[model samples]
Target: MTAAEPNRGLIHFSPRSGWMNDPNGLLHYRGTYHFYFQHAPGSLVWDTMHWGHATSPDLVRWTEQPIALDPAIHPGDLWSGGGVVDLRNTSGLKSGDHDPIVVFSGTQGVRMFYSLDGGFTFTPYDGGRVIAQPSGRESRDPKVVWHEPTGQWAMVVWSDADGNGVDFFVSPDLLQWERTSRYAAGWFFECPDFTPMDLDGETVWVLRDARGSYVVGAFDGRTFTTAWTSPQTITTNPGAAGSDYYAAQSFDNVDRTVTMAWQGGNHGATWTGNASFPVEQELVGTPDGPRVLSRPVDEIRTLRHDTQSWPEATFSAGTHVLGEGCTAELEIAGASRACTLRIRGCFDVPVAPDETLRLLVDRGQLAVFSGLDYRCLNVDLDRRAAGDEIALVTDGPLRVSSLVLHQLRP
Candidate 1:
């Protein structure tokens, strides 16, 4: 069925066949990046769960590998989870050949899986023992991070225990886990991701749910407390469009915060979803509060071929054509509220003066990434062949400080 699907993205990663959701087991091992996800290989929709994998040396080019975990071979539903590299053999599961990789997933309780050959394959740890059990009900998606300050591993898993929250757990060896505390909020749903970012030289832990709603706080290995009890959203009114950016997670063992998310609307005739181009995240202070900003990884530049730029210009309300190509990367700065750029007649992306919106047109997929904020929008262009001419329409006369378009190399 891989018969040259025209709708497939030029740079985005998608499964060869079937459905994919919520990236899992994301980590960097040695020289390659291992990307794992919730996959249904037999159908175009969510069905049987399996761990679909791909490896990348630069995050731009991906090579699909065999299924890493299957429901038939691995126990439980093989739900969404995260992994970590036990570099010090703290788990004692290492065989001296490779560092042990441990991932967690399940429904009511968390199950553990380990890989000896790096992230290429996995085996059920302790014959499928519930490493971390759910507190109340409706639990899934466990994200783990190593706490350097405490010299232990910390985890955050979404659960309905006491009505919507994440259960915090700490493990010394990855084999045994101890439930530390439960951080509950009605807004927290599923697919919880945790990252400790340096904000002005101080480390602050950010916990974000599937919908891009995040809370900034402090973590002392045992508990997470935040003065910002309300919450700040990276993306709003998402899921109202075709595919909301969801289930974003940062890579393990990376020097900086790098994230990737599932673009739910990116479905072709063969594949049901695609990964939003990888982004490097930074914690910055905004007038609202401390927010996380994201931009496409610089490695995406290697895919650029013909580059065009307008350093400064004034534009009227009309379609300003830039290039003639179906696949291209765009960086438009000097956003004006009077501008609402339309992409290929399929998406109406709004522009704010403080935001630099990046539009990525990949055949039938138009992904809009708001650089300053983590807001993202994916327009489903699967039905119509996207317009080859990339253009921006202004609501009124606007001043643009910068505009650049790079045609993606096939």
Candidate 2:
């Protein structure tokens, strides 16, 4: 049998069939944002990998395209990597005057792929494997970017194959790469991202991984020097570590950095894996030093239909049907003890009295974000509990202000 089709009204993204993981090769080219992912088309479980392709005119609605790269074309499984638009013929693979899109993907070692016809198709580079000898068994997920200051390309690759660390590489023409530096950190696993953003007034770089923990530092095109790092990994889901949200990456070709994560795999369906909602990231200064802060992009509000707003409400112990596939943006002021939100047979969250939570419930799955600290969570509900009703249980009376519930379109 073929893969099961995804449930409509799920705010996030999932392939029509098969398995998907990691947001790879996210590039904005020719006015449309191209999203490539790690997909195993044959089954719902993760096995071999292929670069699954999709396009979005806006970040909300997505359209699937043909799979870009297959294991047959490349020697190894196509793992997690990113892409860039070659303004110049940096890789010398540009088909015509228009800029070519370069994609870096891997399994054992990193290989280069370029799409001369926008991002619809890709061809392996003649140079073959750029990094022939990876340091570790889990050394994959290459995050590459253009270092404009040095007029070169830089890559940060994660490797648990050696230990928990990342290897830094620099390239001049996007074909040949040179190892520049290596860094070992706490819980630095797969899906590495190096982003440069302005903090206060100074420019600081953020080094992050799938772990959700990030390090603040300075990058000089070749070397990255760390200044500070968060003590705890900022989970895409706060309390639920094993939840689907994994291997998230930041987007390029935008004014601000936006990120998306792989939701999870095999939720009793023919298809597996989905993406988390995109979030905008920034570096904020704290007493310790600098910290990375993230919030859902404002554009998602555009998808809000049949919006219901309440200036003030009290939830003692009652079940209220918000809407099907709805996003609940809530602010609870005065505090007391604890409160729990039950949606469908899932969407369960025990929040503090003073906490503000944004809960998105769709497709028998729930994604919760608490405060600006932004520890996120995604949980699947029982198919039997699939409904529009939400029951809020509280120890005492809770006052909510400016609570808005917006129904998401399928």
**The candidate that achieves the highest lDDT relative to the unseen native structure:** 1
Each prediction's TM-score versus the true structure: 0.92, 0.88
- What do the candidate models score in CA lDDT, each in turn? 0.82, 0.72
lDDT of 1 by residue, 23-127 (tens): 997999998999998899989988889999999999989999999999889999798999898898899998868999888889889999999998888899988
Error of 1 at 321 (Å): 2.3
Per model, how many backbone clashes are there? 0, 5
* Candidate 2 per-residue C-alpha lDDT over 1-410 given as tens digits, one digit per residue, 9 for 90 to 100: 22223342256777877888788989787788888998888787878889898898878778889899888876555888988888877887777756888888776678888888988877778745555345777678888888878999999888775578888899889888888888787567778888889999887788877867677788999899885544445564432223556677888667788888876633445567678777887777777677667777887777767777666676665555544543444433433457776665455667676677777666534556664456544454534455646656666666665456666665
Q: Which residue pairs of candidate 1 clash? A: none
Candidate 2, superposed: residue stretches over 4 Å from native: 1-9, 131-138, 160-162, 229-231, 236-242, 313-339, 382-386, 391-397
